[model samples]
Target: MIACSAELYCAADLLTRASLGELDVDIVAIVSDKPAAGELAAQHGVPFRLVDGGLAGDSRAEQEAAFAAVLDELEPDLVVLARYMRILPEAITVRWNGRMINIHHSFLPAFAGAKPYHRAHQRGVKLIGATAHYVTAELDAGPIIAQGITPVSHRDEVEDLVRKGRDVERTTLANAVRLHLEHRVLVWDNRTCVFA
Candidate 1:
């Protein structure tokens, strides 16, 4: 598995027990600019490779090249973006295709972008949730695999809502990854039917 964000550490820990050596999913490499992410990889004894350029501002060619370099070196079977905050080029998306997945902070087709917790708070919604889906070029607009929702109250603040949302996010993403690893998710017309 190729983990791209901090939340991936949690996913990795979860996988350690669930796969029970069946997958033996070694975290071949991790890409992040954050020191904490690097530290986590080091603690887990996984090799860390830093992206050479800024993902958001770098040209598509540069980003693709960098991603290709990592793929060449890691040759990961699956790419999991656990809160990695960068848009992937279409070339890479097509190359990896179904082998990639991402976790979003909101039930997709609703709050699909960043600050979803704040968006839910502003809307005064009574429930907030997270979505896990395939990594399509259309940001957060991918086939849904799994989701988890939690109720909010009138007294809840943005931070409180985000805190509650994190738990759901972690569990939902883990479930999605497990299903994908087990080949239990079948995609059809931008939607998913997961066995789990």
Candidate 2:
């Protein structure tokens, strides 16, 4: 559970599944500042923690230091950013390097960053999608891991597109994480060669 952003309940579902050994991984720790997100971690019997609160306006170095401490405790082989809104520091990006992943709400190299569904709706795109990729300093411009798409039409509103996008985001992220945990995804020069 990250910032507890929209559709964060998916985090609960993913972590629950992972706890049940569906992904052959363990939820060593979950870091979020929100009580609700922390509760999700607790419900899954995962240790919950917090990093930069944003109210202090901490520098990237400070934030990275805090995050490093958390990772030190968890010793996770991979870092998954599910609905985590903050753009991480280059230090943390480089430190984690190929071990980190994120799920974006857009098909990517397209409407990235905040509110992609709204932008796609405004542009009248026939299809909107989600992407999961290795985390790098270049924001959403990272090595592609997986992509999931769903069709939409002129009649669909932004809200409808958002609802549909959530489904894509959830499944795409889950699949990417599962592939990574299973050692089925290989990264090479900003692209992924998935074995399955």
Candidate 3:
């Protein structure tokens, strides 16, 4: 399962790269509340589903349950959270466990959660980075699997950082996914022992 929100850039990047046989697994479906996400799945020749937290606009628990049911039905070996923009409850995370991962825009242990790039820029940080890791209940605090970074000068604006962050996010996430696919990552004590 591949979950996403409004924009499909990250999802498209991952699906495109995955389709090239970099890994043995297949992208069975893309789930989202955004229609454009489903359109992206269609363009990429993958199945799509809209998970609206049920038709009644129910509670958080209901929404989570609906998503969990969808995943249960899909039975995918792995789930990639590509700019998914939703915080899942513990129930689903426990079920997916090591099988789930996400790409965070910051190097992590810094600027975690949403709008990381914007925050990093606001702090006038010189170097920005991206981190891909297993999706633990703690937001973006999972075991680090792979990372990518680039320098940002003072002259560079927030938009510039956001642009550069996108590159880092893409490569970092791809590397992490590749490592996971190849079974090259071992987790312990909330850290990763990545085998080359």
Candidate 4:
């Protein structure tokens, strides 16, 4: 697994699972656009690469080339975007279409991007959730693999929702990764047929 993230929670969960033999993944290396994830990788004894939004170099084509070179060097079977902040270029997305997945902090197709908990709170939603899906070029609109929700009330602040959402994200992302690795997910027409 090659996890890309600026935060440590998801990557830490994955690394811990792999260490405990709970997940059947090696977690060979970690790539991040930020240094926080690099610190986590170091703690876990995994190789770390600091790429610019998972791509390196100054120009678009050069960045793509650098991304390709990194992937080529790692030869990862799967790439997990564990709350990776930057938007990936389309070429990279297309190149690893089926082999990549991402954990979005919202239930998806609703609060698709950025500060989803805040939006959810503003809308007075009764439940906050997380979505894990294939990393298509179309943001969070990719085929959904797993979703989890936690009930919330008017009394719940944004921080409360974020806290609850993180737990959901962790579990949902892990489940999606497990399904993908176990060959239980089948994709067709931008939708997923998960056998779990």
- lDDT against the true structure, per candidate, is 0.76, 0.80, 0.86, 0.85
Best by lDDT: 3
Off by over 4 Å in 1: 5-24, 55-61
Descending-TM-score candidate ranking: 3, 4, 2, 1
lDDT for model 4 comes to 0.85
lDDT of 4 by residue, 1-196 (tens): 5656556788888888888887899887887766677788888899997766434336646545656778889889999988877677888889899998999999888899899999999999999899999988888888999999999999999999999999999999999999998999999999999995
Q: Where does model 4 exceed 4 Å of error?
A: 53-65
Per-residue lDDT of 105 in model 4: 92
Runs with alpha carbons beyond 4 Å of true place in candidate 3:
53-58
CA RMSD of each candidate after superposition: 2.8, 2.1, 1.6, 2.2
> Clashing pairs in model 4?
none
| Candidate 2 Cα lDDT to native | 0.80
TM-score for predicted model 1 compared with the true structure: 0.87
In candidate 1 the C-alpha lDDT for residue 182 amounts to 85
Clashing pairs counted in every model:
0, 0, 0, 0
TM-score of each: 0.87, 0.90, 0.94, 0.92
